[model samples]
Target chain A: MTQPVLEVENLATHFFTRDGVVKAVDGVSFKVGAGEVLGIVGESGSGKSVTGFSIMGLIDPPGRVVSGSIRLAGEEIVARDDEAMRKVRGKHLAMIFQDPMMTLNPVLRIDTQMIEAVLAHDKVSEQAARERCIEALSMVGIPSPAERLVAYPHQFSGGMRQRVAIATALLHRPKLIIADEPTTALDVTIQSQILAEVQKLCAETGTAMVWITHDLSVVAGLADRIAVMYAGRIVEEGNVSQVLDVPRHPYTRGLIGSVPSANPLGARLKQIPGSTPSLGRLPKGCSFEPRCASASEACRAAKPDATDYPDGSRVACFNPYSLARAS
Target chain B: MLAFIIRRFAQALFVVVAMVVIVFFGTNVVGDPVWMMVPGDATQEQVEEVRRAFGFDQPVYVQFFRFLADIAQGDFGRSYVHGGSAIRLILDRMPATLELAVVALIFAVIIGLPLGLFAGLKPDHPASRAIMAGSILGFSLPTFWVGLMLIMFFAVMLGWLPATGRGPVTTFLGIETSLHTLKGWQHIALPALNLALLKISLVIRLARSGTREASLQDYVKFARAKGLSPRRIVGVHILKNIMIPIVTVLGLEFGSLVAFSVVTETIFAWPGMGKLLLESIQRLDRPLVVAYVMVVVLLFVTINLIVDILYSALDPRVRLAGKSE
Candidate 1:
């Protein structure tokens, strides 16, 4: 029922490195509606972070969005020049990095950075920006935000610093936020706390979020929809609960089954048999063919098309669990 | 903060005291330097006057204590050559050296910093490569040769500026300084630029490396992600982070500029402390020589203190290091 804020279609980002060309994000597509939290779940190097970077136009040299269409509302933004992207960045869209220190300039005070971020998009005076920055900090549950504004980033704990990063992302009330493992470095308790706070924030503000992470439990609790990635493609995607309970694609199932809680007590967690395939030398057909339990000859011949089930789940596998059972 | 400053000052004073002892003994005890210090081929009367100068030629310890007492009152004894305050003569010459060093520093920073920043931003670009190659020449070429070439072109060939002397001295802030009028600027410009050549090269290398490293930091990426314009991100975010090291190097370089401007000063015939120092060495002016060495030591400590203060101000983490988390 909500309006769509982001639509990424057939996006492929690649790195033209000295050694070889790497398909960082190959033909990935997803959409997030207003207030919807779309969790992009995957192992490291699965193109999850690249997908986030591609959407934000944060790709640096040797790596670029080779072929893609990214639209915010109706604006085609994939190839927009940096000046134009500056207009869209921090206003229509924002990003949260994995490390808060990366977001916080060490020599600058928290207030200086936050106020500058506010002033970047708004034509407000410094007094107005300062007030807004303070309010933003408090909203993120920072105690004595005025004092915190004067403190340096290193003065704060890692969790508090990430909270500051989240606060900064919320400053413009951007339509979409691409957070690349923002709390993967935090303690578990801090991770849950940040997730809950952010979830509450999106619920209240109706901001769409793309949370890129390797943890399934994190997405299970926060996302409205989950997209499971393998190598550089979305292997399976569906409503979070449905995907977690009955993952159609073998990669998604293996991911869910590997979680300690999903396994019966004392049973060794089930892991996918082989490591993720390197994108440059991916196997023909399915990239996961080497590790697939249900892989058939057809699965190795070519990549399979994503099949839709009556339950509204999509799986990119030649022999999906639900389809196999139906046969 | 006051306590921290006081502690650092006390530490600095301790170092100065240690230096004073070494310099006093080294200069006073070596080769009958006092005898050497007596000018005009000391007659018996002049030699006796030297003894009376140390309080009736009091015992060495008595003379040392009296010397210390006089130093505490800002009297560095009288110059053997001029028979005036050695400290005042050094102070009189200080402003000229300071002016040249400061002008060189200003030119170096204003031109070198931005050039280095661009070079770092586009390290592989043709223009940046040219800048780097130019800096290599700056580093390798001799300063004396560079000074001669500049004089030959600007002074000899073009006849735009004067060749020598601090032209028509004017006093400002109760200190004598060269006139900023056309003549004064013309007089100092050549030597200042020549002295700056080496430092400009130093600053360029430092800024380039610092910019390259800081630009890759996460905060720089974050600045870009904030949608800050490229100018703002590089100018503010990147510049502030890289300035710490540059400031450190600049402080040390500034001290070297003051102490080592001897060659440039001699070449230009600019009457700065370095030139005065060279003259005092020839005269074997004991009090003046000791005072000059001590004054330079003092300059180094004071500069170090200023740099530390500036560092703590720019980087709060350094200021709050042991005080809080």
Candidate 2:
């Protein structure tokens, strides 16, 4: 395959707080090729969002990307200064936040917001930028894009607002777009509609996407590949169907098992034994060991590094579930 | 929007009525104006004659109704001490007080906003801490004492500025103002600064808190992610949001500055409405005092209305709310 649009390797984003260092996105690595959708599945505080922020170079003080190499289209992201990084952002990469209502500035008109997003990357005339904004808006399925552009964010429904956000992200046609649960705040119906629209946009535009979400079902329908995160690390990474049908990582298996549809009707829903461990003081061996049903003596002794399997799956475990045994 | 303003005006009228009632009764409680007008050795017959002539012998409610009717016709009665139409006496002084209040407000906002933004942006910096400490002094230091200290240092010790009075007056468009002259600004500077101290402190605190709160909002973070320059992010996005609250507080404060800048005006002998108010109260000039207070009430009502309008302009949500109403 050609070079991936985004490549993040051994990225360690840590927050230096008063109590201790929080390894929010410790040793996370992933790749996204053109038109590919990589869904990062994890619970809250699993560093899924932080990973996105790190890629965008939007991490504020008290939190720093302590160690990592993030490359966007063969350009090193971690090496750029703030000014240079800003030039890359919105031009080469963009972000779509979860809460659409809060993402757009309430006082600013949709056109104003989108026009600025365009002007930030391109030096085109305001009229030209605005036309691009209108085009982008209509591409996201918004009706009467020209009129909608003049309206403030409050005038739009939650779904429409997210569409506006997506339009803003697509304004520059950046190489990569990090969507951090963009549809999570909308109704389920709206969520699917947005999901379909986003999927189509990604395919038509050939823009790479890192769709960070907590819902397994969302990634199942949207992502070509899936990466399961625990604590702060991707414990399983593989083709979506391969990983879903036969999850090698115990955590991944547990997650798939816990889904209601995966279990027989009227049967007890399978659950992981315990909550995700805090990043500050994770277990010595595996971060998921305390809750892992197949945890072994070796799993308790040392942390497991990711190992590649023949079927193009990656599992980070000392004793991963065997596919033959499951079948 | 028109309905909103009309409703606010109605509320303002009610407030004015309440003020008139309270001010009349409250001044009456301070003692009869007729006695204050009379000499110390006046006989009962002489006092009675004077009281009847001034209509002071009438019942309190009757006096209130008469006063209300007089004000409705733009007749604010005569100042007992100044011996002129009370409204005229106050209106002549209005320009000075308005100028001082506006200049003081400008001083407060210009000096406070940037400092407050700095402190908010870099809260842990030593310079920010010093700015915060200076703001605390601005809040706690008595205005009169600050005025005195300013006089001592700038006027008495340095002889750089006039110690008292509004300097060379320029009449522009039938109104007397000291602003057109250079020496006039020097004279007004100390007094305006003294008046602005507390307000500067207030704006600093308000801006600081507002900035801190707004910087945490999701929209601000999103602005950064949009790759907008930091200057644009803070100046446009963050500043605009924080201004909503700051405008509100400063608008009301401007009214108070105009109405009750008594100590600064007195200390500096600035010859404004506040000084007029103080003298009216001291001499028990009921008509002058009442007129001054009513003017202040009008000023406050007008200011509050403007603030509400400005608030709607700044926030679209407020504009929509006004539309619905």
Candidate 3:
């Protein structure tokens, strides 16, 4: 089989503060094949966004990747210097920020910013770059791509701005696109449109994607596979139907159960019992022990190692679910 | 946008009229113009003659009306001490002051803007910190003291340049003389540097603060994430956002440069409007004094107007608001 498009092994990212070190992404391991949409679902501070940022080399000062191997298209990216990393970025890998305004500059016209992005990685003529910009914008469903390209960022609404940002990332047809909650800022209908467009474009280009979001419903509708993260670690990961329908880890089960659609109508939606453990003061055995309902004495004494299943699912739990055990 | 300009112009006209009213009555309340203009040994009849000639003997209201009428006709009356038309004297002195200010502004902006941007981009660097400290010290020192120090070093001690008197030429008409060429630059250099030093410090501080804020803006972070080089991020994205506030501070400081040049001109005895205005005030030349103040006020108003127009051009939000209104 061809090598996975992107692979992360034992990736650990930490934040150092006056208080202490926050283990944001303790040990996240995952892989995305070509044309695969892998969704990482977690609450705020679960390190979902940090994992994406780490892969993209966007983590700022005071927070850094402690130890990790991030291989993009079979090359180690974590060890590359800033210049090498930049070459990979926007060419082989690209990202869409959560806030659309952050992705677009208010002072510059769309054409100026988009064409510059195209010209940065390629030795293309201005006319060719302009044509590519229009095609990208139109591909994202923007009307009058030529005229709209001349307009500044503020002239567009929030959803339109996000579409433009996605268009910019798509200009190079990168191998991997890490979207850090890109749709969280948009309304539901717009979110659905953006997600559909993103999925269609990725499939057409055979691009791998890591979608970081807290919305399980979005993952259910869009992701081909799902990795459930809690307190900086992935508790369970598998093909979308296998994990979402029959979650092995208690934490994953609780998350799937908490979704409104999982509960009966007019009933109080089930909620995960406790908040995520603080990174600095995490439980010694398991980070999610305080919140998991099936915690046992052994689970309290030692962290569970990841156990692989025959169907390609992995779960880190002392007591995992089985069909016979459930009966 | 045109409507905004019209509104600003109307507001400026009101301010000019208010300034004229204050100058007219304030000069009258100070003392009798006749007594102040005529020689001390002049007889009462001659003093009365001077007062009648200026219409100072009329009621204060009538005198004010006549003053406004003369101003409207572009006649600023005659200078009692200089024995020339007040407007002509002021106009003659203006070019010298304006030249000094324009050159100093160019120097301050050229030096201060880059220094500020560099300091902000690399705040922890030793060179940036040293420049920040130096700008603070430069801003705190008085202009006259700075001028004196330059003269002592470049003129008195080294004897590399003349010590004083605008240039080697005694007559103002010989301003075009060889003395006013390269040597004249050496003569004016100290005063101009003194005037520019404080402004440089002001611009540096303002630009640094503006740049720091712009650097933190989301678009700057976005630019970084876009994989653009650091040079492009700092030069294109961050600098453009910072320029609005820096331009505002620079415009106001440039206007103040006109007024502040008075002290530098006095120290160096430069042939500028500030020096002329100081001489007129000492001699109680009321017409020249009023005319000088009006000129300064008009200059400040015009500069502020230009800044406002540029503000709209630089920021689309401002332009949109202007269009809406």
Candidate 4:
């Protein structure tokens, strides 16, 4: 079998603060195959965004990838210096940030930024790079690519800016694209449009993607697989349909149950009890034990190792919800 | 855009008029101009004659109108102490001051921008920390003291460069002029260095803060994620973002250079407008003082206007208002 496009093993990112070390991402591991869209769904501070940033080698001071091996197309990026890592970033891996406006330099024209992105990686002619930029913009559904190229980031609306950002990320046709809540800032209609475009682009180009967002509905509609993270660990992993339909981990079940459509409308929606455990002072044993309804005394004794199920799903819980047993 | 320019010009006109009025009446309030210039005893008729010649004997309103008329026609009256046209004295000395200011500004930008970019890019790096500490000290030290120190180190102690005077420009302007020759630039070296040392610290502080802020911006992070080299990130992406603020502070500093030159030029005895203005003020030359102040104010206003236009060009968000125009 061909190797996955990207693989992360035992990824542990920690932020050393004055009080204590905040385990932003602890012992999280996942992979994305070619043309696969993997969604990492979690609330803020759940380490989902940190995981994506870690993969992109973007963790700055105070927070660092303490121990992890990030393999991009079989090359070890975690061990490379900053200079070498930069060479790998846009050429093999790219990222779309949450704030579209933040992804663009306000002073620069859209064409200049996009064309520069292209020329940075390739020794292409200016005209060729420009044409490629226009193609990328148009591919992302931006109209009048030529005219819009002359416009600045402020000229475009919020949604349009996001599209332009996506266009810039795609300009290099990188092997992997890590999108961290790219659609979260847009309206629902625009969000859906961007989601569909991203999905279609990945499918057609065979680009492996790690979609980091708290929006489960978006994941269900777009991602091929899902990894639900809590307190810097992946509690559940499976195909999207299997995980969303029959969530095994209590936290995963609670998350899906809390969604409006997951439960009946007009009824008090089931909520995941308790907030995410604080990174600085996470509870011992299982991080999710205090919030899990089915957690037993054994669950509170120690964290459970990931147990693979017959349906190719994995759950990290001592007392996972089983449909057969529940019935 | 035209309307904005018109409005800004009208505001500038009001400021200039107000400045002229203050200078005109304030000089009269200082007592008899004749006595102040001639020193010792002077007859009442001599004082009255001096006052009348200056049109001070007329109504204050009429005197102000005459002053405004002279300014409109580019005639800044005559200097009683120097016996030269006040406008001519200003024009003659203006280039020398501007030359020093321009060179000092260039030095400030060249040295400060890179230091700022380095400090910002590596906030925790030892070099950056050292630069930050050094710049703080540089900024806090008085300009005159800095000038004296440069003279002591580079001139008196090392005996390398001349201590004073505006160095001959012809030799410096020549393409073949080398440091080995030490002909013209050697004389300017002390004054220029003195002026730049203080301003460099100011520019570095501003550029460092701006660059640091720009580095944290989302676009910078995005650029990094795209795998652009750190060189490109700092040079192209981060520097451009930081330029707007840096340029603003630099422009203001450039304007202040003219004002601060009063002290530095005096210490160095350089033939610049600051020195000329000081002489005029000491001798109670009202026309020269007014003309000098007016020229400086005009420069400050013009530099600020240029900086504003540059600001919009550097940051798209600023130019958004232009769309409405």
What is the Cα root-mean-square deviation between model 2 and the actual structure? 2.2
Comparison by TM-score, 3 against 4, better one: 4
lDDT of each: 0.85, 0.90, 0.85, 0.85
Q: What is the DockQ of each candidate?
A: 0.64, 0.78, 0.56, 0.72
Off by over 4 Å in 4: B35-74, B170-182
lDDT digits (tens) for residues B185-272 of candidate 3: 7876677788899888877887788788888776776666667777888777887788888778788878899988899888888788
Over the true interface, candidate 4 deviates by an RMSD, in Å, of 1.3
Q: Please give each candidate's TM-score.
A: 0.91, 0.95, 0.92, 0.93
Task: Give one digit per residue, the lDDT tens place, for model 1 in A1-327.
Answer: 544799988899999988788898898888888888999999999999989888888899889898979999868999898889988888889899998766799888888888888988999999999999899899999999988998889889999999888888889999999999998889899999999999999999888999999988888899999998888999988899888887888888788778898779998788889797777877768898889899999998999877777776778888888745533
Interface RMSD for each of the candidates: 1.0, 0.8, 1.5, 1.3
How many clashes does each candidate structure show, in the order listed?
2, 0, 0, 1
Candidate 2, residue A132: Cα displacement in angstroms equals: 0.9
Write one digit per residue (lDDT tens) for candidate 4, span A191-220: 999999998999888898999999999999
lDDT of each residue in B63-141, candidate 1, tens digit only: 6777778877777898877889998899888999999999888988988899889998999899999989999999899
Q: Per-residue lDDT of A211-296 in model 3, one digit per residue for the tens?
A: 99999989888899999998899999999998888889888888878888879999999998867788988878987788777888
Kept native contacts, fraction for each prediction: 0.66, 0.70, 0.43, 0.85
Cα lDDT of model 2 by residue, B44-120, tens digit: 99999999988888998898889899989989899887789998999999999998999999999999999999899
lDDT of 2 at A150: 98
The regions of model 1 sitting more than 4 angstroms off are: A1-3, A323-327, B1-75, B322-325
lDDT of 3 at A299: 84
Model 3, DockQ value?
0.56
lDDT of predicted model 1: 0.85
Question: Which pairs clash in the backbone of model 4?
Answer: A90-B226
